[model samples]
Target: MPDTALPPTIPTAPVTPAILESLRAIVGDKGLIADDQGKQPFVTDWRGSIVGNAAVVVRPANVEEVSKVVKLCHDNGIAIVPQAGNTGLMGGATPWPSHTGIVLSVGRMNKVLNVDPVGYSMTVEAGCVLQTLQETAASHDRFFPLFLGAQGSCMIGGNLSTNAGGVQVLRYGNARNLVMGLEVVLPNGDIWNGLRALKKDNTGYDLKHLFMGAEGTLGIITKAVLKLWPAAKDVATAWLAIRDPQAAIEILSEAHGASEDNVGSCELMSRTCTDMVLRNIPGTQDPLKADTEWFLLLEWTSARPKAEGAEGMAEKMEQFLADQMEAGRVIDAVIAQSEAQARNMWVIRESVAPASRAEGPGLSYDISVSISKVPEFIERGLKAALDILPSIRPYPLGHIGDGNIHFSFMGPKGMDRETLKQYSPAITRAVNDLVTSLDGSISAEHGIGIDKLDELSHYRSRIELDTMRTIKRALDPKNIMNPGKVLRI
Candidate 1:
């Protein structure tokens, strides 16, 4: 094949107010927005990695409204960018460069559609905030276990769209595993009512899975039936300082394997991570209050006799701590004795991001490998980044207990924007390459929104990328759904 000249350039799409008026009439003033000020929030991604201005933003109150809006957009040859809380990390909820497009905001559709304690599940509108769903489940004495940092504001719809994975993923699995059914509004404005809370449905095709992590390119998730668990009678949380990274992995393996998978959660934190949290985050005082190299946040939930006999469980936890201490693997430990205290411990762990940001700007990567191989990967990643770009401060910390870590590097303080941009981005890619070489995912939790689109080509196979594009084309033939996101179209 010889080099050939390409065809003439295509023209940009035109915008008209007549089309805007038609959209506004469908959604009403309260539901429709056209001004740049009103649209700016929905234009850029959470990280400000990608920015796009839409022709309008629409908020539909229900499935009927969403279907109508999507159908209208599709018919008018308008691109639709679906969004929820706009708290998504992967830029999954952010719109991209507009060839005359609109954003579909699901915020107005928030509602607890259904709660079935007997069924151990809750069917909720996609726009429902995670914290609101948690409260709804608490009212029934049941639990929805998709615990994460953004639970307070992140909408379930966005969570489902990205198939988000958080700390509790070790037990409840990712959002895809938690979702039993979905109610999606397709590109053609038809509704997919897979909202049944059935545990087992051997139907021909599990249509819901297609949109689970499609990031709204396939369709907009309007509602979802999520799997819930019985509320545990008691929970024990502990913060410990560990000897080494490898030993920390062994501890998690031993505890999770022996506890009948009862270990609720485990997280690893480095000294730099905690120091920044305590220094920056308001009301974030240290849990240890003393100098510690590394920390582990461990949690265990039990249903066994707490009122009758829980001495054995408490003793087992104490014995586990004692054994670690004796082996010099664990230097310090503090176990929560009450629910309030347990929540406080979590508050500290969740406050890491904001506190770290207050310290300085940094380039972060959320990547994962097998637990057994995480140490090697981290070591190599740190070495690789430093080799290419020394004088960079590494602030690596995350769910090492689960093989997922937000390995990041903070640029030299007080450096100008140009210098950091020139070096840090190169460093981020260097770390991502290291993640790929170990057969690990470049994106462990966050999807390949605009932020990670570059790495998708580097990590994903040609066949894999092609299959994804085929599915996207099949679901959204016009390529109007979330245009220029995930993959360049």
Candidate 2:
């Protein structure tokens, strides 16, 4: 696909009793996963995107345990694949085939170590569920602002590894920006205790960042210190039927400027996306019945305000919408009157993935470009893809505020999935070209797992590619940590 040389196959060592015994001793019964029948669930990823064959899937209880297991693996020259939540879209956490390596799942180590509300930070083990962390933060009157559709199942370690961007990324930035520090187990089993919650640490090169989005190749994240914001005391959500993509952008910018930058999320969806969700997902109704071509789901949070005048904020939002209508930017819109209504409106946006699934046999691609160029990218890319596979149905939607669009193409009528996959790469390449031509990234929120492993080498320049390789070699000289991933070592 990228004209990059495929990696020469590495010889796998026979899993001698000594190897299993060593791993078992480090983590005891709870960590080591040797029996395939029992390790079935952990072997594959959430979407069943990629499956790895780890002879054993180990679960360490703490940093000490992780270091111990990693040390043993390093000594044995056994490759290790780190997994968390298994909800990655790019098959990042997918176990390698042939059971050659060990899959180190951090699910068991899910514990909220501490929440220092005074300092506005929380330290959580890598295994902590994302949704649990969000709830725990709320209990302490603080906010852990990482939001994803998979929050209920995905782990924080995976979030950082992928540098996940969610609906709230427009406000809090991606997962990488929200993290303060991390506890990493190095490639050679050395423990780097970097779990510092300091906001300003000018000590040296920010090493935590390397492992944060490294997809477990550079190191294994054991625990982390994540930054928190003031819990949102009030929030408002609205469904706007916009005239066009440019109008959607204008409404968001205007609302953002008027609301004192309190806007949390601003997403745009075509009627096609809405139609798919309504068709597949049950208990869904269109918020607006107008023949609107596009829609925007906007959210705002006034966290610091000490009064219960959110409706006033809502009124401000109404005026913002009126401004859009006056300019003919929006045709119709509705504001949610209650939290239940807010959740209902959110359901429409979240239902996209499930709806796409129900539609069946599609290629999913999430790529990003500049905010101003998103509409262009979508329009041009969609046209190009449909030209290539004229029968394909395009489902282009996502966080337009940040220029990241989850562009999916459903298989055409009577077309089998095998046929759809044949053109998947063509679709990806066409969109990638458009994105790069516009000076944007091929990946936005999701990490380049095995799904985009080859694409990374193609999209990135030779100098950038070599630099990343050098860093990887410097950190993981043996390439035993998540081998055959992310780069062409």
Winning candidate number (TM-score): 2
- Candidate 2 residue 314 Cα shift, in angstroms, is 0.7
Please provide, for model 2 over 115-142, each residue's C-alpha lDDT reduced to its tens digit, 9 standing for 90 to 100.
8999999999999999999999999999
Best by lDDT: 2
- lDDT (Cα atoms) of all candidates against the true structure: 0.79, 0.83
lDDT tens per residue, model 1, 1-489 = 001111111113434678777777778889987788989888876655557667788998889989988887788778788999888776667654543677899999998877888888888888899989988888888888887787898899999999888888888788999988999998899998888888889978999999988888889999998998888776778888887677788788878754556788888888877777777776655677646678888887776646765454455667888888887878888887777777777887887766655666667788999889888987899898888777777777777766888887777767754677777556767787788778888888888776777668667889989998898888888777876667655
Residue 313's C-alpha lDDT in candidate 1? 46
* Candidate 1 clashing pairs, residues 3+ apart or interchain: none
The local lDDT score (0 to 100) that residue 487 gets in candidate 2 is: 79
| Global local distance difference test of model 1 | 0.79
Q: By summed lDDT, which 10 consecutive residues of candidate 2 come out lowest?
A: 1-10
TM-score of each: 0.94, 0.96
